[model samples]
Target: MIATLVIGLREGLEATLIVGIIAAFLRRNRAPLTPMWTGVGVAVALSIAVGFGLQLVEQALPQAEQEGMETVIGAVAVAFVTGMVVWMRTHARTLSRDLQASASAALGRGTAWALAGMAFLAVLKEGFETAVFLLATFQASTDTGTAALGAVIGIAVAVLIGYGIYTGGVRLDLGRFFTVTGVFLVFVAGGLVLTALRHAHEAGWLVIGQQRTVDLGWLAPNGSVRGALVTGVLGIPADPRVVEVLGWVLYVVPVLAVALWPRAWRPSPERVPRVRAVLAAALAATAVVLAVAVPSGGGADLPRTVAVTGDARSVTASVDGDAAVLRVSGRGREDQITLPASVHRRVARAGTGADQWQVTEDVPATDRPTSLTLDQLVGLFGRVPVGVSPSTNPGPFAADWTVRDTVTLTTVRSGVLEATRSERNVLTLRGGGLPAARTTTLDRDVWTVPPADADRAATDLAAAQTRAAELRLWNAWLPLALLVAAAAQAALAARDRRRVRTPTTTTPGTDPSRGPPADVPARSLDHAVR
Candidate 1:
């Protein structure tokens, strides 16, 4: 909730400031505010719809797909927040000035809608980023309801603050406020990095460095207040894998350092090449590490085939992409049936063939019947082949025999199709010398792949995994790359500060005691409200 509240407060106030500026400009020009408000209302509604729609789509996906979607959303949220933070740090001082300049141009166009559209776009951009970031944070939170309420309250508070600033009823160091919030957001984004890395593994996007190296259970006991703050708010898991810690450290340390780095008043020409060289070297090292470190997994073993054979019949099946093809053989002929592949969460893709297919689903009655039935062949003075059939009733003898057939068709995680067929029969023997009933059963399972197509699919999947691993590795190393740049900035700041303290000769037209120029525009708040 605290994380979300800060996110909401910072984002909401930014939007509020924009709207306030636009409203004040219109009021000064004696232009009505209806069109601008209309645009803002539409943008807000669209942003809300986008957020809800994304959540709904995520919920409707399969487990693996859901994890994949979550990884994407979390990563995107982190990127948006990071970019916003960096951009705001540089632009906050000039924001009011820039908005006024744009507003003036819009009014000169002789249409209030132009300004309205500007307002709409400004709010919409912020709204979209807010929605995505909040969704990611909410998913990380243990109590989503509380998080959401906090966001609402934060936005409410931001509105009051924005109104106060506009009305000259509040006085604040806007520069200081943004700086503090910017630092806080950096930590939040760092946590999101950890969260995204964890999701990437669950989604099967990254496979290397999965060993659990840290145990934070003592620090974050479940259901404890500390746990809620540490795990939920901070986005740290009780037990994190090696990659997770690597990602968190690589992101947090360098990003925080850069965020807190002292600003330099002037650029140092001699140091530029040195800074570039350090960054280039870091990137090159990261590339070399990735090339050698990321593993190219050997192809996984194909699932073993299982078949049940009787005196005159047998059953087996193979995987064909998203579908399953079952083959049943009898006497001198073989028949095939195609069905959709069923996926079970508990089943292991690369396991002993014997242990596979522990759970099987019965073929539904809706399946189309085959041309020939085993019971018909049995009735022709042939040995009774009491084995599994695709259909419950497959021949005339089925009327005299009670047949129960259960079949399972599925595609395993390792890109293999597995099918199991089980059947039981009880036929009434009405002959003078025969017993009252005859009972027989057959069970079979098959795990196979077409030599060409299935192999290609597996290769493609492996290639995708490799690429994703490389991308994730590079992503984790990006912070170290940023550290190079930060180091240069710190060095420059130290040099400049030391020189200033040495009381060097002052330039003719410059005033050293004036310090840095103020960031806020004088007319920003004063002209925004009545």
Candidate 2:
């Protein structure tokens, strides 16, 4: 939502400024307003149509193609915003003058259509920029309604501010305003650059640098509010990729430095200093050293296992780490428990009586079960053995069971059962036409660790192999270079600010009728359009 709001505010203000300048120019020249307004309307309609067309294209594409499209769109938005920020910073002080000059030229042509075309082109540029930015932000957001609402509010506020300025209700330092906003927009554009790189990776255009730089999953789960704000507004995911962080740093640092640097700091060919040259070389060396020292880490590929127990009435369990599977079968009834390694207690009961068939004692035990009493054995084997109640006739006693543990270990057993241990294991019961019975002795064994899954093991190998191949020196050094440039710019700005300047003085008795003189200020025309 905040992302969209910034987009609307920035773009809307640009459009409003253009319209205000054009309107003011036309009213001063006694030209018709209808044509300019019509052009603005048409440009607005075209921008909306283009936005919808992009959305349609995205929706119609396959997943891979959709990712590719998002990458392209994100790239375009970053470029547009970067260009806008730079252009505004360079031209803001003279913006009103330039717009008025252009308006005069268009009106002097004596063609209403020319004025309309000029307004159309001017507004279309800003409108289309807004459209693309909003589209990119919407793609990144989880709540479209909130994003849209924020954008609307931003635009409305921009309009109000523009009106206030035009009507003399408000005053602004346009140069400072553009400078500060340009700095902010540069960061926003950097976020878009990172977003684009991520999309490109998803589309498989780029295969290197898959390692995560940081994992914030524990602190901000994917769908949490804090996660959404970070990812959607700031473009930083909980788990960020190495390339994503590099891209952000590389793009933002230099761009922000350039935007924020004072104009007086700009180097003149005649004034290049030896100290500045030395600083540049030092910064480059530092970046090179840092780049060479940084190491790339490998990706993670953990193994998982699935365990199944029993037949007919079965229990299936899936676990990642250390675990055990316990199955109890007797009569026609069966029960299973997929216990974690931490579990150390067991409870059960027996009998045809409803109250008799209940869990009796459940006490914590430090060791795995190796022996059981008659009552405990009855509960472990199952409550209703042979599926017979006290009211029903009994069947001949018979029971068959098997417990197998596989993956990281393999273990198998048959007939009378006892306690067993394994990382991933399962127990099954067959032929359960039995009467209630108690066992006194049972056998148990520990499982041996087995080899990891072949596929996952292969993936881990590949990830290791790619570690060095994925290392890009530029990714590590670019931010350092930008930081150095920012420092240099700051030093230059400081020097320029401290230098004294002589003010030019007009000769006392110069002719007052010399066409108002070159230094005379132009009459303020802003009020005409307001």
Reference-based TM-score, model 2: 0.57
What candidate 2 gets wrong by more than 4 Å, as runs, is 217-228, 269-464, 472-530
* Total clashes in model 2, counting residue pairs 3 or more apart in sequence or in different chains: 4
lDDT of 1 by residue, 1-530 (tens): 89999999999998888898788778877888998998899888988888899999999999988888888999999888878877776667667767777888998999999999999999999999999999899877878999999899888988899888876687767777777887888888878888888888899886765668879999999999998888878898988977788778877776676566656742364555556456556655665665557554443443424333342254455654545566666679877665553432344332212112333344433332222245554543265544433254344333244456655544444333434455544344332222233345333323233335444544665555555554554544444455565566556656655665666677788874332221233274523321
Q: Model 2, residue 120: displacement in angstroms? A: 1.0
Q: What is candidate 1's CA lDDT for residue 350?
A: 27
Give the best candidate by TM-score.
1
**Cα-based lDDT for every prediction:** 0.67, 0.61
